[model samples]
Every structure is written in C-alpha cells, then in structure tokens.
Target: MSAKPFSQGVKSPIVHTPSSSSTTGPEQDERSTPTADLKSAHRKVDRRLVLWYSFVYLIMRIHVSNISNTAIINLEEGDGIKAQLGGLTSQQWAWVLSIFYYPYMLLEPFATLALKRFTPRLWMARIMVTWGIVSMCQGATVNYAGIMACRFFLGAAEAGFYPGVLYHFSFWFPTQRLSFRIVDPETAAFLSGPEREAIIADLPSRAPSMDSKTFDLDQIKAMFRNPTFVPFLVIWITHGIGGFGITFVLPTVIYELGISDTAISQLMTMPAYAAVFLILLTLGYFTHTKRLSPWVAGIGLEVAQIIFYILLITVDNATAKYIFVVIATAATQSFFPIIWPERIRATSGTTSAGLAIGITNGVTQLMGIVGPQVYQPKFGPSYRVSYSTSVGLLTATVATIGLTWLLVRRQDKRTEAAAIVESEGVGLPGEKDRTKQQGC
Candidate 1:
C-alpha cells in the first residue's frame, strides 16, 4: 500500500492527452468555427464586388427614376426637348409610359431561365450595357412613337435583372443568412465539393436534385398553390399602381401646391424621394431584426398610405397636402423589400424560386400600364380621381396582407404539429402501429 507513487519512475503505461491546440479534429473544427470568422476572411473580396455592384445599381436606379423627372421638366420648361414632345397629350404620355411594361412583363420569366443557363456576371453586363444604350436613345426620341419604341426596347433589355439578382442570391445563401443582405462568398465556395455533399445529405427528400439542370413546369405550377405567392402578387401590383401614380404626378402636384417657380417645384419633390430611400433602408433593418412578418408591415404601410391619400384629396391647406404626399410616397415604396424576401423564402428549389420571382415581378409590373392612366391631366391640380383610386388600391393591399398572414400562421402550426408527431414516433391520427409506419 505504501508503494512508490505513479510519478516516482513508475512508468505508468504512457497515457496520451491531446493538447489544447490539437483537441478538435477537422470536422469538429469546421462545425465549431464561427460564421463571422469565415465571412471576415472573405471580406476583402466581398467588399470589392459589393462596391462594383452598388455603382451599377445606382446607375440603374437613376436610369429608371429619371423618366419621371424628365417628363416633368419637359412638360413644365417647354424648351428644347420639351418643345419637341410637349405637344403630346397626357393620354399619349401615359401610353409611352405604359408601353415599357409590355415587353418587360412578357419576357421576364424567359430572361430568368436564361440566367440559369448562363453566368450572372456575363448576363448582367449585357443587360446593363444594352439598357444604357436604350436609355440614351429614349432621350433622343423626337415624338411619342419614338419614345415609346425606345421605352419598349429598354424594358426588354432590363426585364429580369432585379429578379435575376434575387435568384442568384438564393443560389449563394442559406435560408437563415438570406436576411443579412450581404454577399457571402464563403457559402458559395463551400457549396462545391465534400461540404456541399454533406449539406445536401441533410436536406429533405423533396429538395431539388443536384443533377437536374432544366426548369420544371410542375414546380412552377405548384408555386401558384403556395399561400404566400398570390398575396405577394396582389400586394406588389397594388403598391406599384399607387406608387407610380404618385411618382409621375409628384412634380405637377408640387407646382399646383402654389410653388410657382418650375425649379422650386422640382426641388420640392426631392425631399419626398429622399424620404422614400431612407424609409426603405430603415424598414428593412427593423423588419429583419424583429423577424416581423412582411404582411404585417405591408398592412401597416398601406393603412398609412390610405390615410395620406384621403388627406391629399380632402385637405385644402397647401402645406398639409404636401406633407401627406411625401408620407404617402414613402409608404408606398417601402413595402417591396419587406415582401420580396418573404415570398422568395417560401419557395424551395432553385428553379422554382427563379420562376416564382420572375412571374411575380413580371405580373406585378403590369401596374406600369395602369399607373399612368390613373394620373391623367384632366384630374390635375386636385387629382381627386387619382387619390381616390390610390386609397382604393391601398385598401385592397391591406386585405391581401391580412389574408397572407393568416395563411402563414396556419402553415406554421401544421409544420410544428408534424414535427411533434415525428419526434414522438407517433403515426398520424388515423394510422395505427407507429413502428410499422416508421418507413412511411
């Protein structure tokens, strides 16, 4: 019992203990590592790419939004380009504006399919350059038909770009990280070999097969059955109609608000546009952090818009009317980002997601056709008809959102119930012999 202790040259069978640095094996190390570390490793490359894309996006926004500004300047200044096209009636101008949507809506789905078959970098470059040329041609057009033709071609060129980018994001990000709104090249790169195989192994059996290259018609049809899809479609359409109507008539409205100077009228509209930009960014952040339903946001914003539109139509005070106009414009523009990610998140497979986005965006853009018609010059100054129409549309949007939220909640409960039954090794209510039902 009083024998030599273990450390006293007893040479106890050498027990090996792992050092702190070498404790984790490769797989464990990968699993335990922080996602932020991986993102930071690729931050340099991501930053450069983001900067480039941001510049491109900025240019695209300018090209699209400048049409409203250009139309107003031409109508009011009656000089140079204005004199050439100013004689055109408001109805004719509406036609010009509406024509842009025809090709855009019809071809967007096809464009998204093409993106799947090609590299996004190449496809996006082609789209941007072609649209740029077409935008310049629009400025040079001398008459109604000329501008209309340019707009049509421009729409054709830019048809799927926004939705295509969204689809591209789906390929590069996981569901949980999608709300981060930043590019994650690490995910893209890791999803290539063994890591990808490991991930795909865990996905549901219904997940898209990796070998399938072509789009599936059945999958596209199934998207229509998804509860999230129709609501998003309706919300976007109503929002687009109301938003575009406000945008096109904003300058005229400002002028009629007793701002006599043409430059002053144009300048006054800037604050509203600026407010829209800020509101979108702020709402995006808020919704992401709170895990808020897009429908809730949509309903809230649409209600606000309805209020603003009513005031715009009923209020007589110039300043009060202008305030309402700005608030309405901002509310209208803020709903898209909230709803877009929600709709796309509900879609599963890559091809299905692309088609869903393309179809949703293409159809919703039909608002372009209706938007100009709503803001006719005959209703100008007061534009009572226009504001009334907007209120109606916003009300419809709120109803659609309410329905969507209900469906989503119901779906969540179903999912949770299914998971509970599975975990408990229980058969469905009618089924007996849970052990026998295991395979099924």
Candidate 2:
C-alpha cells in the first residue's frame, strides 16, 4: 500500500472483517494483520495506556467503593459511619449507596459530547479534580442528609469518567485492540512525526465521513434502525442487573455471611475485585488472539455466574458463600471488556457510536440504583430474592446476546449478498471493498 502525505485524522486499527461470502480471493482475506512497526508501536501504546489509565481508573473506583468499605471500617472501635452519623440505619445507608447511581447513570451519554468539546486530557483532569473535592466533602458530613447531598454531588462529579474513558478508548484503538486504549496520533507528543504518521496510516478506515466533533442525530436514528441496536442496549441493562448488580452490593453481601470479624469480611471484598482483574486479563488475552467469539465467551461467562449465584443461594456455610461470591463477581465483570470493543465498532458512523456508547454505558449503571435496593435489609440472611433475580437476568443476558449475534450475522449476510451482486457485474465476483480514506 502507498499513500500521499495528508492528515485524515485517525480511525480504528482493527479491520471489521466482512462475512465469508464477501471475499473469494485469498489476497483479500481478513488476516491482513498489522506491520511489525505498528505492532511494536501498539505494544508501547498498550504499556502507557494500561499502566497510566489503570492507576487513574483505580483511584476513581477506590473513591466510589469507599462508601461500601466504610460500613466495616474501624469495626474494632465500633466507630464507623453508622456510629459516627447519628447511628445511620441500614436502610438509610442503602439510600446513600443508591443516590450516587442516579446522576452517574443519567449523564453518561452526554459525557461523550463533553469529551468532544474539551478533549480527553482537559476533560479527564477536570473530572478527577471536581470529584476529588466532592469526595473529600463526603468525609466531613455530619448527618444523613449531609452525606446524601455529598453522595449526590459526588455522583454528578464522577458522571463522565467511565463513559469518557470508554469513548477515549474507542477513539484511539481499533475495534480489535479495544479489548485492550486512548491516544491520538495527531496530538501525541511522545511519538516522532514519522511514527505518528505511521500509526495513523495503519488504522483501517471504517468511516471517515463524520468529524469526531460532529453530533448527528440522524446517524443515531439510523443506529436505532439497525437490528443489533436494541439487543445491545438490552445487553447493557441485563448484564448490569445480573453481573454488576452483585458487584454493587458485594461488600454488604460479604458482611451478611455471618462472619464475626467485620474487618475480615471487609478484607474478603478485595479478593472478589482481584478475581475480576485476573479473569478479565485471561478473557482479554484469548479474545485478542481471535480464538474465541466475544458473544460466545460472554454467554459462557453468564452461564458460569448463573451457576455460581445458584450455589450462593443454596449454601449455608459462610466460607462457601464467600467463595461463590468471589467467583461470581469475577465471571460477571470479565465479559464487559470482551464485548465493549465489538459493541462500539458495530455502529455505522462516529456520531452514532458516541451517543449509543454513552446511553448504553449509562444504562449499565442502572443496576447500581436497583442492586442496592434489591439487597435491602428485608432480603438479607438468605437474600434469595437478590440471588434468584440475578439468575433470571443472567439467563436473559445470554438470550439477548445470542439474539444480537444472529441479527448482526443476518445483516452481514445481506451486505454480502448485495456485494455479491455488485461484484457479479463489475470488478471481481464476491469482492466487497471497504471504504478507504483519501490519499491512501
């Protein structure tokens, strides 16, 4: 391939492989991997993105999950928030947990627009600083209402972090590497000019029509008309319910295991998150290697969690229950990385991708509100209501993902059929050429 010098901006490095029917020639095969330079550059990109952003992401999670951890904090002294804040009730604490999800869920989609306006560096720094202030104010709360207000503002302050980061990843990496990141070629000071140009040139141009900053409602409507849209949206909700739902209340769920040592119970929660990290690493590696279909892997993970939840509901032993929760949390959280890249790239245009990503990610936070409510005091001890509900939702997620895959597969067929017809009369039968940017 040869290209004249020009700036077309960057697109995803991953190729969106067409259906088998679209290509008969071996040269047009989907296995046209990146050059050694591109791969090496990607490794460097991966190191910086993973290490730097992981710390940034970790700090945000530490702040969010701190509220849950507080229930068990200073347990030996019996001086936790429950004791400090006029003997806050379990129900009120639940509300504190619940309130954060409201703004966090609602504002997620629009956050992408903010990402567009301010650019990632400025936007992220702005988010982190504001949320830090709000979080610090939370430590000074005197009463239930004071804490509630702090939590609300905290949520509002933290609204865009996850969505903003995901949008950043979508912008920088390919659909394939997305399972792995955000960096812009044009603006990256770390790379020399030739390397920057090489990185941009290596990106497979899926669609270059819409500007990164453009907001096109019609494209979003076109996204809605796509068969895969509703299913993917459903996926965001159900997965949140079944998977992240447990994640939200995991600290409490561990506390409920009749453990006498409150500190031990608090420490137990760490393992589940650790399990999530490990599982994601394992799942991400195999998916990146193209050995597993993300939808299939997601379904399998959901199925495993369903079994774990059932075991959780049935087990009377606290140790047994804790083990199940850790594994279940791992299974639940592991699949999102697998599906996120594919989900975003499936859209037709840039505008639709941003909006859909925002809306769907926001919807996933719905479980944060609903999860706390489901694990209310009334459902405790056995918590059959919560566990059973998770099983049903995981079941729904499996079905929804299957439906989405079929819908997208059918669309691929239609695209291939049209391409087959187009090729029959023109250049090469079964050849379906993708759109490439100018000067390439």
Candidate 3:
C-alpha cells in the first residue's frame, strides 16, 4: 500500500475499500445503532404519554361538563339529580352554572405559574385529585348555595389542568409537531432549526437566568403588542362564547325538539357527541396527511356552523333540526383543536407562551358566565336568541381568523425577504451563509 500525501493547501487523499459501499466503519456503525434505537424508544414513550394524558383530559372534560346535564335534569319535574338536591330557578341556576367559571378564570394564570414551580406530573395530579373531590361533593349539595360553592371550588381546582397539559406538551414536542393540523412541505422547508429553538427558548420560565431578564410589565406589554397575540385572544374568546352557548343547553335543546323522555334526550346527545368525535379524528387525520392549513379548515368549519345555526333558527321539521344540531356540535367542537396549536406556535418562550395560554384560557372561560346568561329561561324551548347570538359570534370568529391569516402571510413575506438579504452578504471562507439556503 502507498502512503497518501496531504498538501498544505489541499485535503488528504481518499481511500475506498472494495466493500466500502456495503459496510460502515466500526465507529460509524456503533454511533448509528444507538441513535436509531434511542429515536425508536423516544417515539414509543411519546405515544404512551400522549395516550395517557389524552385519557386524563377526556375525564376532566366529562367531569366539568356534567353540570350542564345536571342542570337540565333538575329543571325536570320528576326525580332527577337536580330535583333530589335543591331545585333552582332559571336565573338561580344560571348563577350556579356561571360561578364555577369565576374562580376558574381567576386561577388559570396563577396555575401556569405553579406548573412552572412544581413539576407538571405533580401539579397536574394535584389538580385532578382535588377537582375530582370537588365534583363528588356536588352530589351532596342541598341548595343553590351548596351547589354554587361546590362548583366554585371545582372551578378553582380544575382551572390550570387544560393549560398545564398544553404547556407540558410544548416541552416535549416542537411547535409544528405539537400542532394538531398538518404542515405543508413548502412551509416545513422554510422552518429553520434556529427559529424553532428561539420559539422554545422564549417559553416563560420560573427561574430567570443571570444574564436573561424575567417576565415583567414590559414583556407582558410586548406580548399583547405582538400582532399574532391579539387576534388569538379575540378568536379564543369568541370561540368560547359560541361553543359554550350551545353546549351548556344542548340536552335541553334536544328535549325541546319533541323528545319527551328525559332518558331518550340524554341518550340522543350520545350519538351527536360520538359523531363529533369521529369527525374530529377524521379531520385530524385528513388535515395531517393532506398538509392542509388549519386556518382554512377552521374557517370552513365555522362557516358550516353559521349555516347550521341559521337552519336551526328557521327550520320547522324536528328531525331536520336534530340533524343540524348534530352537525353544528361536531363542527364547533372540531374548530378548537385546529386553532389552539396556532396560538401556542405564535408565541416565543415558556413565560410568554404560558402567559398567552393562561390569558387565553382564563379569559375564554368567562364564556361560562356569558353562556348560561344567553340561554336564559325567558327564551325557553326555542331559544331563538341563543342561536342568533351564536351565529353572530361565529361570524366574528371568521373575520378574526381571516385577519390573522393576512398577518401571518405578511410576516412570512418579510421573513423570506430578510433571509434573502442576509444570504447575499459575504461571509467567512468555507462557510456558506445558510439564512436563505434554509428557506426560513
């Protein structure tokens, strides 16, 4: 074998074995195997964690929302959950329903902070256990005040769980993967690693670095000032108001549509919820596979809801109305999953992201207060006013989303232009500028 020479200005000569194409060096083989194994292990663990948290979230939602069913049962004359306790008036019941949200809204921001101080596992467990206890206490309430107290405490206990899970997922996944909707390859190509890192680094932290500043008045102001943040607030609030308005009174609405039997009406709700779940799964899979824009999908669903609300208000056929109700439920419920990830992705850092998530959760839960008030007893049976109000809010949501899409497009253009300029500038030897090359 001849010795290969290395020139001062040139690289060393390359040597290739006859089997080089079929085999790797010992170091290369060793390095690749563990990395591949580690990735596979991580994926398995991620799937299990996602499934576990999803189940937890489902139970929490069911516990919080069962109050709506309880209220309707109490309204009925016969023996029911509400009748056995203390019977509450329409106005009084509204108060009971809305009170839970008061503490819920107030405590959410603080909960985000607590999640930062304590580990998510511990904090989330504490939230679930306490809320579960509060939920059980509701069964023992004797009067409006007792029920109200239980609801209030329940709200306080459950306040942070949803947002906490969101924050927890943000830690495990990149923003794109965290998003329920799919990202198109073109957009994916433009997303640079540093940009993603910057997004992650910006999340609000409990402990600020010696060189880094803490989340303060200025950062708060900056967050609100961010073009994307304000629109998210609007979208979340309107979505909450519209979504809860229908959901809280859904059982009653079904009963009013000539389903005289209470059990039948409750059972009827099951099919609608099941249909919505299937729609959500289908939409999630389709959007992910097709690389569809969540904004576009969300807007389309909101428009469908608007049409459904119109049909509910104007149509006379009971069967037809029932079908529309099911469609509307599925559409409205599916919209949140599409939009929420966008909100999380728009903000940077843990503190700002937490604040964004917290504020959005806290403010939107105010719908609990507004929702019951909208579907008052005065508008009973038909509840024309309630449907009309939902239509208006849904319309507003569409407009807000449109504005957000425009803003995002403008931002993308600016980013691309800036990257091009940076790449055009000269750089050090052997180092090609990747600003434009990365397409971000």
Q: In order, what lDDT does every prediction score?
A: 0.61, 0.66, 0.62
| lDDT, ranked from best to worst | 2, 3, 1
- How many clashing pairs per prediction, in order? 0, 0, 9
Best TM-score goes to which candidate?
2
What does the lDDT read for residue 213 in candidate 1?
54
Where model 1 places Cα greater than 4 Å from the true spot, the runs are 1-34, 41-50, 74-77, 80-82, 174-212, 415-440
Question: What CA root-mean-square deviation does each model show from the true structure?
Answer: 13.9, 5.6, 13.3
Total clashes, candidate 3? 9
lDDT of 1 by residue, 47-95 (tens): 4344455566677767776766665664445562435775777788778
Better of 1 and 2 by TM-score: 2
Predicted model with the maximum lDDT: 2
lDDT of 2 by residue, 18-99 (tens): 3321212222243246666567666666665546566787787787777777777776788877788889877887788899
Question: What TM-score does structure 2 among the candidates reach?
Answer: 0.86
> lDDT tens digits, residues 1-440, model 3?
00111000000001110111111223223322333433443344344445556677678778867877765563456666556556556788778879999988998977864665665556777888998898889878787778889988988988887776665555434333333311111122233544333322332222112122324554465566667677877888897898667787778788888855666787778777787678666766555444566678889989999999999899988889989998998788777776665565454444565677778778998688899889876686777789899999989999999998776555444434443444578444433332112111
Which scores greater on lDDT, model 2 or model 3? 2
lDDT of 2: 0.66
The regions of model 2 sitting more than 4 angstroms off are 1-31, 75-78, 181-183, 207-213, 415-440
Off by over 4 Å in 3: 1-42, 74-77, 179-218, 415-440
Error of 2 at 21 (Å): 16
Model 3 / residue 431 / CA error / Å: 22
